[model samples]
Target: MKCYLVPCVAGFIAFNENLDIVDYELFPRRSIISKLLEFEKGLTAEEEKIIKRLLKDYGKISIESVHRWKYGKFKGVILESPNIGGEYLRENLREILKEIGFIKDGEFQEIIYEIHMGMTIKRLEESFREQDKLIIQAVSTLDDLDESIGKFVERIREWYSIYFPELESVKDHEHYVKLITEHPRREDIIKLKKLPRESMGAELEEEDIEIIREFARAIRSLQLLRKSIEGYIESKMGYLAPNLRDVAGTTLGAKLIAHAGSMKKLALLPSSTIQVMGAEKALFRHLRRGSKPPKHGLIYQHPLVRGSNWRVRGKIARVLASKISLAVRKDVFTGEYDPNIKEDLYKRVSIIREKPKKKGKKRR
Candidate 1:
């Protein structure tokens, strides 16, 4: 009752509690209560945890004060005065106020009223005109914002196309979308300053800005680290030269060895065998040297060592020698069968030699 209907205004006249109607103050209890509580400007992690725990335990605990933390809400005080009287009182007050004005009387009274009312009517009409102008300006500003946003999106698409040329078709949209999500351009723009101008010109297009903007929404996403990608590409290029040389060498070796016999013969032949048999070192050296070396060394790499039982390794070497000799003579070892050589060998053997001569007579 003291807070609600106490003669606070009259108290200044009766009691000298340093009070006067001239100095009457509105001592807001709510403000005082809020001040009494330990309020802080910012929350520490511990405080945040406490708040979250309270919220979790209580289901939902609203601190009406904290609603201002959002983008548009925090602008002003939200003093929630109750609407118990409803809107009826406000409408009645407006109608009564409207009726208190001068009436539209006849002749002299009307003329006098018009003379007085002209300026007020003109002022109100001018206010409405100003409102209309403001509305138009607002619409123009909104249109500009929309156009800017559209251009930003177009630029992002164009930039994406430039960077990832493989996505020229609709089929590549999935890959392009993935790339945009993975490496957005908006976050990248800031990091772009770190990259060389030439590199940016070579890679980024207008579309990247939109992509980056979209990616930038993820606060933790590092769209700005454009140099990292460049560094990776540059690093990869450094090893490309040596890898290409190795690939070429391996391919040439395969072709040459395949024409000679098969990979098995090539593997068994040693470098020592190739060298002793005078095989072309240029054709096999790149493969033989360094980490791989020659698996099969010198002997069996020669073709003549096939029948030699000096030792398994020695026979291999002899075969290698024959191959090398054949390669030198005909550029490749044909190992073609000759009937004359077979007949001569049969003639030399006692049992088979006689049978072949008798068979030859029967054929004649």
Candidate 2:
């Protein structure tokens, strides 16, 4: 019934009726990624030899989760505690921990045995959620990044409309930005690319074009940054939810996880609910105004649904949702990769598309 807390580079402390400081340090001034790698790489034999005695005293890492421990593991998590103060979870323990490291004249047991020790978990839920949060944040960042990039590009397009409106018609953001960066001047730009010279736009001075090029180069950097962020999100998503990633694709699967708040929640959802995850507005309308409910939410972005003819769109959404529901369950519950789900999902979408639409009833 006591609160268990981990204090390290970053950790969590749940608030319950009882709060107790767990006596130990997981890692000192190190990140979760490094710590994980360290375990995989393992300590040098010399280092291991030194910690052998310390390891003898320290049991496995046990996360003293106040909420989950009270009710049951994974069942009654009242509320998630944020990462404990980054600087230090417990300030007073600093002196004690520092002293504990120093063993004077074989008195290591005296210092170690004095404190009540319990667990040896590599880290806690923070490590798991750190990756989840990283993925979620990367996915979320794309929205703001997209808007900023779009606004910048749009402004550039309009501004450069004076120099060359035809350039904007290229519709390739990267290429367009590259052209601007490489040859900002009207005459130079004309010389470099075989692009059309047809524009009724006014020409700009070299000074003006240089300023525009500076902005274009900055925007291009952001475009590259956007691509990198997307790659990171995909990598994290694939690791965290391979089945979901395979079936739903990275961005959409991350969206579903974000909407559901977690993979656990998404796994628990019914296929019907998963189908309408982002349609809160339409769902409200269906309840409040007797309007037609949405057939798909964000998942409508899937090619199977978006590319389908109108007749089969809803069917595709339904089948896709069912597969996603299954995929997520396996991802959360089993943590195993099921290649068949991806194959079967696309197959089902194809079958659904080929099925002939039923005739509409003729009413008087």
Best by TM-score: 2
Q: Cα lDDT for residue 151, model 1?
A: 52
lDDT of every predicted structure (CA atoms) = 0.32, 0.65
Instruction: Give one digit per residue, the lDDT tens place, for model 1 in 1-364.
Output: 0011011101101111121111112223233222212233343233244334433443332232332452132222222222212122232323322333322222322332333234222332344332223222222333343454445445555655555433344344333344556555524522542433232334555655553535323211212122232333234222321221121122222233433343335335553444343244543675566443322332333223323333343434433333333332221233232234323322333332233322344564
Candidate 1 off by > 4 Å: 1-130, 166-364
TM-score for each candidate, following the candidate numbering: 0.15, 0.63
Candidate 2 per-residue lDDT over residues 1-364, each given as its tens digit: 4232332322222222233333333443334444433533533232233233223433222232233433242322222344232224354334434444533443433333222111111222235534565566566667777998899888888888777776766788888888888877655666676666655678777778776777787788778767877887788887889999898998899989888887888889999999988998999999999999899998998878888898788888999999999999998888899999989988888788777778899999
Displacement of residue 136 (Cα, Å) in model 1 is 1.0
Clashes of each: 41, 7
Highest lDDT among the candidates is held by which one?
2
Model 2 gets an lDDT of: 0.65
- Candidate 1 overall Cα lDDT vs. reference? 0.32
